[model samples]
Target: MSKELLKGNVAIAEAALRAGLQAYFGYPITPQTELLEHLSKRMIELDRVFLQAESEVAAINMVYGAACTGVRVMSSSSSPGVSLMQEGLSYIAGSELPCVIVDIMRGGPGLGNILPSQGDYFQVTRSAGHGDYRPIVLAPASVQEAIDFTVLAFDLADKYRHLVLVVADGLIGLMMEPCELPPFQPVRTTRPDWALTGADERERNVITSIYLKGEEMEGYNIKTQERLATIRATEQRWVEHLTDDCDLLIVGYGTAGRIAYTAIDEARSKGLRVGLLRPQTLYPFPEQRVAELAEQVERLLVVEMNAGQMLEDVKLAVAGRAPVDFFGRMGGMVPMPDEIVSAIDESFAKMAQPA
Candidate 1:
């Protein structure tokens, strides 16, 4: 397939469609609005399901309804808009419904800005909604990644019968890059065995998140935890850059990680043994890889576009094996390459100091 210059959000939208997405329900929100906009027309032209719901709340609930029918369904929104979908998300998750959600993160605490920010790190990774389950999160660093991860997100969601989130900062959402979209997959005609298709089967299938009895709820929780453990063990993914024989390591993801690549290259030219570990799966978190790298590096620096949210996870993974330092920008500020390089130097200097 020929690579086309595509914007991130549009690429994701098209990729989702080609991945056999049967339905799309979303509200318009900046940075991510283009995704819904693109789908709005394409879905109609293709005679697939597409609806602009009254609100983010309505959109996610609509996704919940569509997913119960065992179709490849999804929704997209920015940070605050995603917040509105949390309850519905929890409902979908509890019911063990497979669905995909895309979060094009924007600056926030409350309506912070429409610019890129990884502020939703905690919101998405540490259980996107209330309760113990964490969604499988894919962080895309470029437009190509955005496209690939969208397809992957659908597959993983169905494989596990759980929610999967493709998260990117506003930068990746708005940026344009050359990307080759996947070939279209035909939509599935038959519903899965577990789907609620009018209960006409030999045995009635009950799909729900509510376990009314205390013992039943506890049992369900145990089952969910076990599923999460399996996902964590098998799905941890990350990209290592110049990791071999490096004394200083950097940990970042999404846009922050993308910028760190440039900083690491510059730091390498400056004779610094700096490397980068960019996580692709945020929930699985690539903890094992980080722990292994921690044993080799003298210190680690974590960069973020938020107030060091993922820093805590990096620290936990290191477990005091190496000193972990953090640098971040909040409320829509993206760190520059030189800024990260400077932070790398500061980390080295800190390492040189007496404990």
Candidate 2:
């Protein structure tokens, strides 16, 4: 494998190209603009399709159209821009199209800032569009993870015949890091026989998640939940650092995960047995793994770019077995290693005191 230094956005574009993506439809959004730019230039040279759509809404619908044609298609946007694409995302999910979406998260509630933030955690993993459907969400903490997950997103989308989202932050999208290029692969244009191509000699196939009757809808929901259970069993992934002998467990993802790593290292140097649990797949959330770690640690601290969004998941995983604490930096403000370390110290002190 050839190693090259690349920005996370460019690496993701390259990964898509190597994964044999045929089309890329997206709008310009801050912190993720480079991804579109890189793909736009490369697609033309590679004789592929790349369209800078008018808006995120148009871009997502464009993805829907291209995906319906059995071509590999992808789109990306930031938080506010992703919110605009929710309707289309819901359509893609409902239609059961195999496509990838990249959310290089930025601070948001409205037009929040352009800096990196994990505030989009709940939006991407829990709710962004409407519905009871869950998209496979992959969280990448570093630039390398961003590239790796972008390719994996395509595979998972196709394997499950569902939408897969690469939920990254601006830091992972814009930071420069060394990445190994993946081997080239041929694009597969032929979809499953079940796919909704145009009606011809065979019977027409209707691809939709809508069910008119309550019983039918209930059946669909049951199937979806079963699939989710399968995903949870087979796809949960995470990384542990110094956990074998730790008393404190830090839980984080995306850039905040990297920050928490540093904090964990610093605390270890000070003779505090602090470990880290970084979730890679946010949806099939590694809940069982977190619960296992909770059993071993005395206290669990959840660090994130949002105020207590991931913390809720940690609490659910621990189920009151351990004291769960939270540390967050919102509105595009990232917490430094010192701040994380301080939070760990404060949490430890609180645990040591009487109730």
**Using lDDT as the measure, which candidate wins?**
1
Off by over 4 Å in 2: none
CA lDDT of each prediction against the hidden true structure = 0.94, 0.88
Which lDDT value does model 1 have at 284?
90
Expressed as tens digits, the lDDT of each residue in 127-169 for candidate 2 is 5599888899999887788888988999998887788999888
After superposing candidate 1 on the true structure, give the runs of residues whose Cα lies further than 4 Å from its correct spot.
Answer: none
For 89-194, candidate 1 gives per-residue lDDT tens digits of: 9999999999999999999889889999999999999888988789999999999999999999999999999999999977998899998999999999998999
Best by TM-score: 1
Worst 10 residues of 1 by lDDT: 196-205
**Candidate no. 2 TM-score:** 0.97
